[model samples]
Target: MKARDLIVLVGVIGIVLMMVLPLPKMLLDILLIINISMALMILLIAMNTKEALEFSIFPAILLITTLFRIALNVSSTKLILGEGDAGEVIKTFGEWVSQGNIAIGLVVFLILVVVQFIVITKGSERVAEVAARFTLDAMPGKQMAIDADLNAGLINEQQAKERREKIESEADFYGAMDGASKFVKGDAIASIVILIINLVGGFIIGMAMHGMPFKDAANTYSILSIGDGLVSQIPALLISTAAGLIVTRSATKGNLAEDLSTQMLAYPKLLYIVAGTIAMLGLFTPITVMSTLPFAAILAYAGYRMQQNLEQKAVSEEQLEEEQQIEEVRSPESVINLLQVDPIEFEFGYGLIPLADVQQGGDLLDRIIMIRRQCALELGLVVPVIRIRDNIQLKPNEYIIKIKGNIVARGELLLNHYLAMSPGYDDDSVTGIETMEPAFGLPALWVDEAMKERAEVSGYTVVDPPSVVATHLTEIIKKHAHELIGRQETKGLVETVKEQHPAIVEELIPNLMNIGDVQKVLANLLREKISIRDLVTIFETLADYGTYTKDPDILTEYVRQALARQITQQYSIPGETLRVITVGPTLEKKIADSVQQNEQGSYLAMDPGTTQQVFQRFQEQIGRLVQSGYQPIVLASPGIRMYLRQLMERTMQDIPVLSYNELEPNVEIQSVGVVNV
Candidate 1:
């Protein structure tokens, strides 16, 4: 395809051909020099990389280099045996190292082999294996931490995806290195084998075919063989060291040179100690003081210079920090940052900090995570990250929960005491500070650890401080869940459902209604404490009846009737009849007659006098239902149910107003009271 890719393919093919075809001495010499240069460059690059992943392609490079070296060994061996000479490079290397003495050259070659094979190669292989194992093992933990950060709103979806990809890449890079290290080890062994073959084959060929005596043949072939070995082994040693460096590199902010300079010389005092040691060793151990004194003086001077640099650096850093702080105060973005409000916030005083501190055995964060999950299941809305912090503005034992920067609920906790509430009536004998349960406003007492068991035995519901706070926080979120789901959040729900049920989404959305229309319906349901988890059913209903009316109110009524079974199950127990307050025919007629219509849609326009009478009568019925511990559900005809709800919403927001059709036919309903006006 492209020039570079073609060159790579040709290079690989040439390496294979080198083993079978005899190349010219000049070409072989050039190839050998190129190999050495490549190896040196690789070593330099490895040292400069800050992390192993920065050179992720190294494993492939290692394999290719090893193969190229082996091919060169084969070509060189053939030339010495067949042509009586391998190449000028090999000859120069052999002569230069041996100095016309073959024994010295052979010893030097053997030492390179021992160090490359036994030390560098072996250690690199082990480190690669361990690195790979640890990377793979840490993947799950890293992935979960990313998810937690995403849920906490510390990172967005794109950032989370990038983190996940990085984790997988690290695992793959280490695993490849684990296998690639073996090639370097095998290349070492192959070099030794090729060296032996070159020596034995060259000797036999020189004497048998070239008519040379034993002494002459030994001298000639010995230099050629050792020369070939030395030329290859030098590059192999460099590469082996490079491999070790790459695998052992950790993820830090700087390259090897930078890290070495900063960390090893971080303390100038250490250099002073080393200088003293050198001076003492020369003076007391009978070594020449002249030999060590100059080195010791240089070390002391360097330490002195480094200490001066450190002091100047500290002064410059302080100046820079002050300048940055001044600039930040003048910047518009600083003010802008304060304007951004968190969707939900939990602030507690200093004394209650232990409730959120993990080291103090507090599990408020863990509880918040669970609370978010519970809200998702119950309300079918993803609660935004609850920002938790300590505020010195409040009383020591006081805490407050805010929704959209406005304080919605506040409570005080006695961390050392357990909240004990009587089951039905007051327990005068259970002596403790009087308090009201913040979640439900029920009368309760804060009893210490001593009286906890006694209160429990006396039919009092006991809960710890964390649980009390968690319950209050949960109730506040549930009460305000409708405010949290806007068009953006509704779109999220629609996308989630689209992933699983595409047919309903594609046909319903933007065809009969848009996101805003769907948002209004979802908000209405959440406002009434209805779970929208069954999205497939909701979409199906919307698609079925959406063409008749674009009004969210009427559409919601249709959806409720379609979800009758769910609503029935929500109100009625398995074998118990549902008790409800019934709206009489006279009030229903008044509401139905008062329905007024305009271009925007219909709304209840009843007179204030009739609305007042209705509220007075509805509150009486609701009072009876509450005293009897029955959920105050107002049942009315389909035509007037929504109107009645609109009237009672402000006064009795927690009460459920249901139409007769919004219940299952098989369920029995008992009317406990009637409201007529």
Candidate 2:
């Protein structure tokens, strides 16, 4: 084993030996000196550590040191009782501190015991117990904050992990301290008990065994007992003080001495007041002027000097700030920085501050984080961090959501009110401010908290202000999700899949199509509100059919056909027939005949009049389907599905066009309407 490990192991074994065996006076003296030195070192280290975690091994060290001290006491007690001399160190201490007065030495030792056990050890133990409880209680909140920062892109994954680990370490450290404090308390009690035993037992041995006179034996044993007690109690007091410091110390950038001086002497006005109070006491009280005037003069001088230093520091700080501002203005990078824009931005009016500020119970940021995760799950897109700020130019209750510097949606909210939407029964019994739901454009009302119960009783769905803005933001992101996935995002997605399906990505990318082509196909799928989460299937379809055509639109259609089961399950209600609108066979044949192809790809070559007639028929049939309360889905042949969707995309953006081949065989279909041209 290494030398350090061997030394530690031997040291621990030596401590156990000290308890079981008697020690020579010379060896006992050396161990006693070492104990005193170790206690002093512990006290100094505790004072210098800026945080508890900086000295995380302190609890284990404390246990070892406490054991070592008790073992030394055992050996010293044996030497003093059996041989009448514990060590030169103990005898010298007893003489120097007590000055031959055994009563004085005994009183001093008892005082130290009381101070350590009653004041420092007890208070530190209580503080450690409370600290451990509170640290564990706040752990969940700290973890959630870390997660929020990670999702918002404020910190990367490594930093988040480090923060989480630090929180856990803090909890464990405080818990260990809570248990370690008990050791110091028990050590204090052991000191007192050992002191009593040494006195009582030493007197009996010196008189009965050595046949000494009563006065001589009393003097000899009392002095020896007092000396031993003082030797042990002094180090115990120092260690107890150190324990107090460790538990009470708050985390700081500076050590204990620096923090104390900086905080205690921060304001010169307080020192000036102290100087004035001393002068008043010197003049108004019975105290002599000669004794008080000098101290008062010193206080006054120190206060004046501190005041001057404060003014100088303020002036220097102002000058430094001015220099920084001048440098920032002169820097060329400042101009370039203005051109950068956030991918997504959220701006709110001053009145809505409480809805975004965490301290004020605003959970808008948390909601935004959830929205990003939701988008990733449903649409397979990564939403960027939304930069939130306040705009004074807008109305007090208004907020806006923007994508890439353009405003997409805006809404207004009342801070102290809940929004209520009717359940389609046209119940107007509950009165409130009328408004429109920002997410769905349904009529809603801003009802006060007192009216929330009545609104609920009237069969209206109620929501809070933050929920309103979050719901609106969710919809806006879903609608513009296609634009968010670019070349970089597409590459990231492919690299992620490559970790799991390396062969498929390697065979398809750069061999049949590049990253940009794949991006376009994914974008097309997202544009039609189809999830690209099944990437393995999408890539497999591309690898099989990409050689036939390099067109992204055609590739997307093939990908859709491969994902037929997922698409059908997404739109179809379980155990219900799929309701759809079908084109008449004659009209389908006409569309098929109108298709034209060239090197540049296919296009519709029908006459303008015939195309107009087809569009009008679609409008009429879709309108009839809507009037009959049926969701309108256009069914067409696989060859014509893409063309049909392209023709109707402008006018029927919400309608989903499907091919017969994309439908599963087990799914039952019901044609609700027919189109003819």
Task: Identify the candidate with maximal lDDT.
Answer: 1
Q: What is the lDDT of every predicted structure here? A: 0.91, 0.88
Q: Which stretches of candidate 2 lie over 4 Å from their true place?
A: 1-330, 593-600, 603-612
* Per-model TM-score on C-alpha atoms: 0.70, 0.57
lDDT of 1 at 267: 94
Give me candidate 2's TM-score against the actual structure.
Answer: 0.57
Which pairs in model 2 have colliding backbones? none
Estimate, for each residue in 478-500, the C-alpha lDDT of model 2 and write its tens digit: 77878888899999999999999
- Tens digits of lDDT, candidate 1, 591-646: 88999999999999989998899999988989988899877889999988877888
Provide backbone clash counts, one per model.
0, 0
Lowest summed lDDT across 10 adjacent residues in model 1 is found at: 422-431
**Prediction 1 TM-score vs. true:** 0.70
